[model samples]
Target: MPTFLKPIAPWLVILFPILTLPLKFFLKRIKKTREILALIVPVITTLFVSSYYSLIVNGEVLTNTVFKMNNILNIYFRVDAASFLFAIVSSTLWIFTIIYSFGYMKEYQNKDRYYSFLILALSVTMGVAFSGNLLTFYMFYELLTLITYPLVIHVQTEEAMDAGKQYLTYSLSGGALILLGIMFVAFLNEGVVLNFIPGGLISKSLLETGRSLEITLLVFLAGFSVKAAVMPLHRWLPAAMVAPTPISALFHAVAVVNSGVFGIIRIVYFVFGPEIVISLWTGKLFLVLILITIVLASIIAFFKDNLKRRLAYSTVSQLGYISLGAFLLNLEGLSGGILHLFNHALIKITLFFCSGVIYIVTHKKKISEMAGIGKKMPWTMGAFAIASLGMVGIPPSVGFNSKWYLMLGSFNQGSLLIMGLLILSAMLNAGYFLPIVVSAFFKEPITDFEEHQGFFEAPVSMLAPTVILAIATIGFGIWYHFPSLVVEVVVQNIF
Candidate 1:
């Protein structure tokens, strides 16, 4: 813990929840007011996380006793380098989404309620990012599920409601698994050492026999898998696209899905430890499942005509890359996986946000409907092109950074088959993604396609977020050096 991080403690636990109230009740009818209120917390958050240089320098372990339960259920919070890393991603992007939602949802009647959900979601996400222990993380995790429900069902249609219901079921069931795992750990009654820093939690001799270890591993993987949007359990993600575009960005890219990946990371590094990850078949299992998911989801994505559904499947595949890096159980793989958690979020959210912008302006859904769309909505299509390129793992984009590490990790493992599979997956990614970009920009305009003639890329608010994220995707990708200092802070205790 660094001293600069101490400043972030009060911000996450106290000021964060306080920031949401204004948007939830009083700002319900006022879109402009709600947007203003949304800025305060995340701005504070960014300042806090970006202060990593100072925090690490001062060597302050910023821990807060938020509350406690039965001595065993201590509700504490901390924002070490690991916590700040995710916190920065979630909170920073949230500011963009909140801004984007302002204009995106302006036409909808319930602007106030929409803003409220955004604030609550951000709060819960921050809590998850900064949680000190499994118990604290679970509490915030369940809260995230509940808070984002309204965002998912924002359309208030029967379809939206169904999606919301199923979404809740998947998320809550995952949470329950996590809860059970926590209880089991508690029953073992290890002293109140709760923070989730990666590496071996206990000595290898403690659970080296690997029986209870496997059962607990199942609980941990199943719980986090639901959020990671892994295969078989990922049905809710595409269905949940009934949510507004900003919400979709929040769920798939930034807050919701990342939380799952983040949880797996915590389990691997903190709960079980990297030593445990390597000692058992856990590492092998993680690699196997992630590779299987990458190929399976890519195949499924090719058949998806619905644009959002395609993105959803691609998401599952991409999440596999993140999960795979972790399972490789090396510095390159783990660091790449951890960093990709943020990089992918930026790229995917921008892609979805662009799709939403098109839908908002032209009511287009199927890729077939987007022919010559670039002519009508140049800005949106341009942003779409860049974002899609990023998704395809092209150069000068954040997606490239994640894939670069994935490739390096694979090579480091000397796993030629996984490397080959990675290449094939990238090609598959290009196959599905290129056509959408090409259709939008290269194809001749079809007369029958409806164009809100005057409409151009939703609104400035929406367009701005998409552009910013798109630029971020490329900017971070090109200059991509993980600040050695930040890494030192984050991975210090683990490695």
Candidate 2:
């Protein structure tokens, strides 16, 4: 790396994108300029993060403390293998989302406001990825909620407004619970610092408090689970599909929901540790909730004809797999969960991009209405089919690789129940996703005149990203060794 760039802390990966938000007004005066700036920030961040691969993977930790507001309330950021994995996934996929947004958002109103929040959300997401302590993580975590509200309600329609209100209600309530958990830990430890390590930060004295400790754990889990969209707390996500497609792809697939999944991993491996978390009935309770979420969300997806809505429910279920891997209390389990963190981002984003393409070019949103879409838009539907197969855990798809590790993790626990849950979930995934592919290809167009109209494809700008991500879905799966090594390196560091 160049000496000038060498001085830059990896945390600037977050700050760099944030600096763009203030420039929105000036950039907005020229539409193309604003969009290019939005795309450039994430692309630059991606390059910066790639520069750290050697340092992060070699276990050389990078730390920068931003502020010291007394002992318990300092702000800190650190980069490690695990955080870098998330940082790379978020930045890489976000570049494609920006590209997709250019084509998707061209005709939409309030492009300035939409781009600002999208950029800000990316900055805060990087914050969540690099946060060095609980206080810092919570700070960024809450800011993510505030910044994403505009994107959720970007349409400013009555339904969009309602969805935004529900999103805030759920997120704020979750934040309150997280704060309560932090207070309990701070009171017990005399400071609010909790760092990621194999053994958790909870002291023996605090553990002896028994019920109090359990309550704190449950409180923390409940708060973060809302974003993870686990079970009953997941209502806000499906409702928020009122937002534009790029926002849906970013928030539900990659950034927002993943924040919750990341939080649960931190709690399990960092704050509480597997030793303590596994010893409690809380582990079993969490496992049961994740299992319920996995099964139930897949079932819901089967019945929904609205494409984005189906994907929303699918995200809820797939997220359960991540949480399930964490709570399994073993290395194999943790590794599988973390691997899916990166893998699923690519898979889900491709699916959403395809859905957006379908809507933009054809004004079709319902799966039932897409009978001849495959013939009409072969490239778009082909990408959708490939991603759909991956979602079902088919071989040579990225989804299958993660599911393979998760199954091993489940069997390692000697829990037939979890093993069975994985199989059943895959079946449910196929139940919902495979039919879309089949309908697009094997089934005939519902209307005869459409066959005479011939084929059409989305704009190259819109089509290219989905195709690239779709290819990545297979390429990453086939060449799974490197990414698996990265994930294993991260899991090895923590466990």
Candidate 3:
């Protein structure tokens, strides 16, 4: 990283986009300039994050104090391997999402408001990623919820507003639980440092109050798991699909859902450590819950005919895989879980982008309506198929590589049941995802809707990102070393 950019690089990645909001008044005056600026902001953020790639990969932890709360409790920003990885992914993908949105939102109202909140959401996401301690994490986590609410309710329809309310109800409740859990930690330690520590902060002897400790862990897990969409808590996600496609991609694949997964990872490996968690009944219970979420979500996905709803269910199922991998409490399992963070982001985002493209071009949003649709919008459907295959854990795709690590992790833990669970989940993944591909290609195009069909495709702005991400599905899968290496470093640091 350049010395000049170093002091502010981390903050800049977040702040630059935000500062653009005020400039929106001027940018919006010129349509072409506004679009160009929107794209430039995220691109610059991505570059800034990448500039720190070597530092994070080399296992450096960068910290900068934001505020002083007292001797032991203060808000600071830190970038380690885990945060760096997430920052890069979010920043890079935000660029593509903005580009895609330009094309998708062109016909919609409140473009300025939409773009402004989008940037705010990204800023909060960066805050969550770089938060130096649990307090910092919690503060930003709460802010993330509020900032994203407008995006969730963007359409202002009855359904969209209802979904927005559900989003707030679930998210704020979960935030309260998490805050309560954090309070419990402070009480337990008199002042627990929110810093990430390898192998966790709590000692076994400190957990003598077993039930209390177990309940606290459950509170934290349940809280984070809501956004992670673990079981009954997941209804908000499917409902929130009433929002725009870019928001769906942002919530599901990039920021909102992933923050929950990242929180679980922090609680497991950083706060309580694997040894403490594994000894508690909560560990076994969490593992079981995650598995149930995986299997049940996949089954539900198989039955949903609505395209985005099915994908939403699919996000729920995939998130379970991450939690299960983390709970396995071994190096391989942890690495797999972390690796999937990136893998699933790429695969799921591509899938959502395709959904957006289809909606923009044809106004069709159901699986039943998509038969023979591939012939008209071949690139869009083709990308969708690639992403679908990746989601199913096909070899040489990012998803397969992560699942492979997860399987090995399960084997390392000597749980053949988990290994079998992977197999079953993969099959279920295919049962739902592949059918869409098959119907798009093998089935005849619905003729009653053939009123107008000739080389149909989403606009260049949207199609470009979809294709790039689709290619990335294969590119990263084939060259898995980079993500695998960083994830391995992160796991090593934590464990």
Candidate 4:
């Protein structure tokens, strides 16, 4: 890439997908053309993002300013190690999701609208990842909520519509809180541009003296927590499970929830910095709440009979680990938290993919209905079993490595309670996930599935991604150093 052209990288990545919106519309009647466009856009976007990997790994920050409305509001894009990590993970996994969608959505209605919003959501998520300032991030973040709303209600049933309304209510309320925090930041800093800095934009002297700093932290946490699915703000998630499984798998699992977690990260590490957060009481309170969410959500997950709803609650619990890691304010905790963002995305998506395949093949959604499904859909259930173990933090799976670092972080803090909560959460994780696996593989077939025979599985398109991500759950666990390298760069920059 040319030195000057490097600045255009982010714009190109964003624009490529947006440009396809019209192409998709033009080719609406041509189903083959639309499918090819949908598939190729993500692949090209991922390639473009990867081309910049060498630059990011070599410690270069690519920044572009579109324009400035004033000192306080500007349109800016930046790609550093942190943003690059998010972009690469989302874009890379998106390829698999798109491929999986081909198989899963083949019979579904509204193909054009689904693929259109789906592609548009990718652009918006990239915007969130590359945003260089609070204002920039907030704008893109709001856009993400709107773009994905249609997907949430794609089925258009009364239940789906209700979920969409609830999603909007929570998301808009969270966005409002974030906007208020931005105003506080601007007023405190005398209208300085709210650009994200490595250490923090807020001065330590101000942090120590300003009581409002604590309030500001609270507002930001509350805002991002709604989307991160932190407790009291998490009801929207379980309700939204009525969405089609691919939408649930990608938007709910990877893009939307991760964006919320990513925002909280920016607030703690980039906007406020660890030093400032560590000195505030709000940080400890937030940490305590995150621990509560981790354990409580897992307990709820154990009792849900519906598989997607169970996974929805599981997502709520797992997301707390990331937030917990970020708020710990220790290097080990931050690294673990950041790394889990990618690791958990891989594991959760695999689970969701497997669930979609199970529903398609056997029309089974409840855990009780899945007995001996392992015999009929061996490949699907095997991948599900692998992902389940990963979710439980078993060894040689990626989930274990991130959880290990989290425990180290808790130990570094010398807080036995935090460590205990994590251990308890893991046990709870096994309580819910292992039983399903055991019933599928070890128990006798239920009457409904007794007629199923051996070696049947989903289409290659759907089964391939599930198996690949399951393999990656262990593969990346063994080669943990690769992702850790990116995370170390991120931690170095922030600390």
Winning model by lDDT: 4
Count clashing residue pairs per candidate.
Answer: 8, 0, 0, 0
lDDT of 3 by residue, 16-126 (tens): 778887776765667566677778888777777777777777788788886787735788778888888888889889999999998999999987788878888888899
Model 4 C-alpha lDDT per residue in residues 334-356, reported as the tens digit of each score: 99999899899999999999999
Write down the TM-score for model 1.
Answer: 0.92
TM-scores vs. true structure, each candidate: 0.92, 0.96, 0.96, 0.97
Q: If the candidates were sorted by their TM-score against the true structure, best first, what order would they fall in?
A: 4, 3, 2, 1
Q: Rank the candidates by lDDT, best first.
A: 4, 3, 2, 1
Give the poorly placed runs of model 4, Cα more than 4 Å off.
1-8, 25-31, 450-456
Tell me model 2's lDDT, rounded to 2 decimals.
0.87
Model 2: lowest-lDDT 10 consecutive positions: 447-456
lDDT-wise, the better of 1 and 4 is 4
lDDT of 4: 0.90
What are the per-residue Cα lDDT tens digits for candidate 2 across 47-83?
8877777776576778888888775688888887778
Model 3 C-alpha lDDT versus the unseen true structure: 0.88
